[model samples]
Target chain A: MHEFAIARSLVDAAIDVARNAGVSRITRIRCRIGDLQQVDGDLLGDAFSAVCDGTVCEAADLCIERTHMAFDCERCGTTFLVGEWDWSCPGCGESGSHARGGDELELIGIDGELNDGNQSAPKCV
Target chain B: MMEIKVLRNVFEKNDRAAEQNRELFDRRHITCINLLGGAGSGKTAMLESIVPILSQSLRVGVLEGDLATTRDAERIAALNVPVVQLLTNGGCHLNATLVQHGLEALMQHELDLVIIENVGNPICPANFDLGEHLRMSVLSVTEGDDKPQKYPLLFKAVQAVLITKCDLLPFVDFDIERAKADIRRLNPTAAILRTSSQRGIGIEDVADWLRQIVNERQSLVAAP
Candidate 1:
């Protein structure tokens, strides 16, 4: 349902990265979305193509990297990854453990060929 | 051609607007909370029970955000509390921009606590920050215990979790312990409170928590 806005933002980001790199066309866009975010892959895919109309990323490939929520124990300082929704700290049974590396929504990088007919890959900081 | 590197966040614009809202609330010494949950989570009912009780001690106002209808606002108005309703039409969630508008309309009256009842949806509302000091989620026992598991984003971002409709716990198959465990697993720090707006169960506790939050915010501001 809200995938339309997310798709628009993703495409907008890819186009910005591509245009700045002097690439006339986009080959692929890589992203990392967390499992906790509850994003539907199919809906995002559909929205991406629809929102990319007339944009530089019209034919770009979207690659998604998925990760589960991970938490670190506050008392014993133990770190573990959780597959299910339960987020208890594995070490000391204490709550309020800090979360690590889930809930990410980022455009990691873009891959495309330059207008001069040479394949180019721009590295992002 | 020269390349201009841009690493802009997709939600940077919304975050900026939310920051402005935070600044405004801080300046006014108002404690704002964004109440989120699925439809029929007892949001309006919970407010109906708490506002009058809280008003005895503090000045309170509400900004009801919904897709259509001013029904919720009308409910609060019956209690004689200052409230404004923002109609989103077909939008799924209420963003910071809409809330900023709501604040302007609500500021006509002096309010100590401003609770924004967001549109009833678990997923979309998690993405938009309405410039609130805290986010509280309402979960009714009838909505199943796995709701926290199903929508982790709402649970993860919320400052506290309120379990509503507790009066029916004897009739239904709701697992209170399991639901608490599930929420703890997702959000270790979220304060869990159980209540039933129908029976006035734990309403005072909820009111006490709200007062503590307001007092804490005041102390934080008064700190050097």
Candidate 2:
């Protein structure tokens, strides 16, 4: 439902980054989405494509990397991916809770070309 | 030709807006609640039952977020409480920016507590923050026990989970204990309560929870 909003923001953020580095055309957008957000990757991709119209990232491909929600056992101290509705620590019988790396909705990076188009300037964003 | 590693959150703008709104509420000494639930999850009914109880002692206001209709806002308005209805125009969820705009109208009233009833959605609303002090998700008994597992993020992010329409338990196949247990697993610390707005059960408990948060914020503002 909010994929369009997210895609708009992503395009805006990408444009800002590209403008800063003197990039003229964007070709790719890499995003890391976590399992916790209930986001539909196909929907986000379509939304991204729609929102990128006329922008530098118009032809950019949205690459989404999915990650599972992980839990670091409070007692056993072992980290494991939380299966469907299961918070039990796989290392031990103790109950596990979400610790880290679950709720990720990051725009990891963008691939674009420089304005001059002679030699691509690879400046870190 | 160039790969710039941005490594930024997609919701950064929303998060920043939410923080600003949160600061405004905190500075005004008002406790805010972001009420979220799926459609027909009894959110409006729950509010109808609790608002009167809360208004008796505290100055309360409500911001209703809906896709199109003003019906929810009208229901809240009938209670003689300060209410504002934000029409999202088919948007599935209410973002911080919308809430920020809604706050402008509600700010006129001297309110002790403000409840922003989010758009009826179990999935999308959970992803957005509305600068609230407390997060409450209403899950009606008719929705079944599998909801928690289906929408864990909503359950996990909330501080309180109100299992509404408990009076229908005998009529429906929903298991109250299983529902509570599922919510408990996803969110161990969340206060889980069984409520039936139609039957007037557990309204005071919900009111008490709101009061606890309201007083906690008010005392902090009054302190050195």
Candidate 3:
């Protein structure tokens, strides 16, 4: 649902970066997705490929790095990464802690090749 | 060829449009609130309770965001107020660009208070800011008590939390104190309130808070 919309925007951003860099085609895109974002990686990949039809990023590979939710305890002033169902502070065994990071959806980098006179390779179908 | 390193936020474009929308609202001195929650979390019901009460003195309008159909918009129309429905078709959340477009449609009615009912989903809607002066989170008792723990971002972004469906609290095992504590653990500063649109419980309190926010926004705009 909304993952497809986000994937479309990411693909659009990758294309914009590639065009700005004077690249003819994009080879790979590196994205950082947080665990709390509720975005499906497979769905995003398929949606990206489907939306990039006839665009420069049709064959581009989407490299995603999944991030985890971390929290910092206010009482004990301890920071820890919450795994699975446990969000308690490991330092003081506190039940309540404020969340930090792990909700970001950002594009880190894009790798593309500039078209030169020698490298006239045909496009991949 | 030069290696270009552009560490850009993927939502940069939408954020820019949202900024523009904010500027437009500021120039007009409008008190805008973005209502966000999961599907069938009683967002429209909250609006149904508050809008008519506020319209008694203040000019109010609504901007509805939904996947399809104008059902919610039709309900708001029953009050005989100005409302515009922005259908996303299949989009998961309403982005800033789409909200800007909807604002243009709402402006034709010359509204004072614009309540944007965001597409229902705690996850996707939390990511996009719809260019409002205030963000409010809506949660119903039927959605489970652990919703605040699971969807922290929605509660974290909003200034207040509205817990709806208190009338069914007798039949269901929804711990009101636990829900408040869970929300406070995530957001210590959030204003919490319990409401039941069916039984008219806590509706007046919700209206009073909305009035306070609207008045505060207006004073801030009038400040030298």
Tens-digit lDDT track for model 1 on A3-60? 8877887777777777767788776777888887778999999988898778777777
Q: Model 3: residues >4 Å from true position, as ranges? A: A117-125, B1-3
DockQ leaderboard ranking = 2, 3, 1
For candidate 2, write residues A10-125 as lDDT tens digits: 88888888899888998887788888788888898889889999889887888888887667677878878766655577788675444465678888888888897733334324
Worst 10 residues of 1 chain B by lDDT: B1-10
Best by TM-score: 2
lDDT of 2 by residue, B1-224 (tens): 67788888888889999999899988888899999999999999999999999999999999999999899999999999999999999999999999999999999999989999999999999989889988999998888888887887889878999999999989998977777766766677899988999999999999999898899878888999
DockQ, prediction 1: 0.31
Residue B215 deviation, candidate 3, in Å? 1.5
Interface RMSD of each: 4.1, 3.0, 3.9
Q: Write the per-residue lDDT of candidate 1 for residues B114-140, one digit (tens) a residue.
A: 999999998899888878999999999
RMSD to truth, every model: 3.6, 2.7, 3.2
lDDT of model number 3: 0.83
What does the lDDT read for residue A114 in candidate 2?
Answer: 84
Candidate 1 vs 3: which has more DockQ? 3
Which candidate, 2 or 3, has the higher DockQ? Answer: 2
Interface RMSD, prediction 1: 4.1
**DockQ per candidate:** 0.31, 0.53, 0.37
Q: Give the TM-score of candidate 3.
A: 0.91
Backbone clash tally for model 3? Answer: 0
TM-scores for every predicted model: 0.87, 0.92, 0.91
